[model samples]
Target: MTDATHRRPSRLPTRLLGACLALALLLAHQPARADDALMAGVHAFLYEQAQAHGEDVVIEVRPPSARLPACEAPQPFLTHASQPVLGRVSVGVRCGAEGRQVRYLQAEVGVIGDYPVAAREIAPGTAITADLLETRRGDLSRLPRQAVLDEAEVLGQVARRPLAAGSPLQAHQVQARALVERGQKVTVEAQGPSFRVTREGEALEPGGEGERVRVRFTNRELVTATVIGDARLAVDL
Candidate 1:
């Protein structure tokens, strides 16, 4: 009788397979881990945008409660581009190169920055001087909508209504001082990348700085231009 020794097949491969299966199961239940990265990406984007406006931003990002498909390469943008980034906002996010997954996120952005306030009691129709305006630091997110943030925006402008001392000014509280009058000869500057052309045009309507006014050129060409300064208008070509 010949003695034959049988060798047992290795169980190492079976153990490795079992580990992989366990990992897959664990990952399936923890889909929100990817969402954590997604929200982080969203926060970074919002923080950068807010920083561009010269504000110290504190962003509170809220993740979606529902489980979402595993996402990679997340991109975030303002859902309403015209709306201010402060306070509670809705952000739209796109995932992957194809952007096949689109999701909306809610967030609260605290913007700490300087805003213009009345240095003293301002009466209506009073021309705002630098002495009359003071800078106040606070969370701009809590300010009234359209609150003035830049001192340049109010300097030389006229108050539309009475403002209390040390109170933040809003867009409705002031008006740009009228600089161009109707039928006045205004210099219409058409500027381009390479050159600038200026022509004299009669203003069809009165406009203040940063306001749009209609101008009629000598050739009877009517165009709308922005008032840049006193009797000055510009058109970008």
Candidate 2:
């Protein structure tokens, strides 16, 4: 009897088989979901933008419920109207092989920290004090625009409106106390490169520090001066 050898048939050629294996490996190394790639890109972009503002930002990228096709290169960018880069803002993420395919995802970015909040019901015109203000850890994205983050910013400043207890402080709700009163006598000091002059004058308008006020001098000379301190104004000569 002649010896017989059994042979197995190959489903794919050697080159084709190698290609399949390479593709499988590539997919395995990539992110399992397209949203994951998009989320990462958006997080990185927001982090870089926030860092430029001298803030240590904590960001959370909300995942999209809709499924996205697999993409090779993903890019994240801010919308044109998303100015100031604070509070609730939308970020766009584009993903595709060559920019031919693109999908945009909206993510919520927030800064994590202790922000100023009213500890008691503060009446309008009341100066903010340390005892009446407290810091609370919260998401800054949901907070109001121009929210006060530091207590020092509102301290010694008069409230523009009544604030309820536990309410967050906002920049628009506070104003610097007036340093010069209208019709009050003020010292007008003019300084130049080589000379300095001082005269007693009457203020025409109430002004805070660094604010401009019109002053009438003893000689009835009218001049605009910047309030530098209590009863003090400076004019550039």
Candidate 3:
């Protein structure tokens, strides 16, 4: 009798085997596990390819001159395997999705591009790329264009007078300087018979001219005086 026995049929078909192999490869390429928790986070991903053919895809980035805040994620979602994360993102400016012109895009970690992306994660010192896009609207607005206005700044003093359009602003009017303190030793000069002893104890540091200054006497009494010429002082009765 012949030793060779009849061969058993293969469990999987040729096409089925090939499909199984392809599926396995795809699974391997993806993350080991998908995050199910939906926490508020940013999602900045570049399209694999550009959509419109022969169309200019321009990306406008805000330069460091303005110093904008971080780009935020649009929705609450889990992290994707391919997405770049800068860790613990928060609610930033909201960005537009799939539009020729987008306004107020929330800042994100960073964005890639199918159409030559120049997008990046916005931060304190991030340099913005000046790429103006000529669309129906103005320049493409990114997630963050300007810095975050803190509570102090938001409620800070505004221009008391109405500013006309295209008016040049002076630095002093916009910002207030530090005021002088009490008991600061100021230099006074002796002129004529009256040894112009600046009727007081000490003067405030950086004492302002024509500004009120508090003078403490040896008796611990407070007397207000006026700052006159350079280092000169006059007691205000």
Strongest candidate by TM-score: 1
Candidate 1 clash pair list: none
Q: In candidate 2, what are the lDDT values of residues 56-122, reduced to their tens digit?
A: 5767677765665665677777774536466556776666655666566565566666788999899
> What tens-digit string does per-residue lDDT give for candidate 1 at 52-86?
55568899999897888866677788999987888
- TM-score of each model, in listed order: 0.71, 0.66, 0.22
lDDT score for residue 126 of model 3: 26
Give me the candidate number with maximum lDDT.
1
User: Whose lDDT is higher: candidate 1's or candidate 3's?
Assistant: 1
How badly does each model clash, as a count of residue pairs?
0, 0, 15
lDDT (0 to 1) per candidate: 0.88, 0.80, 0.35
Worst 10 residues of 1 by lDDT: 47-56
TM-score of 3: 0.22
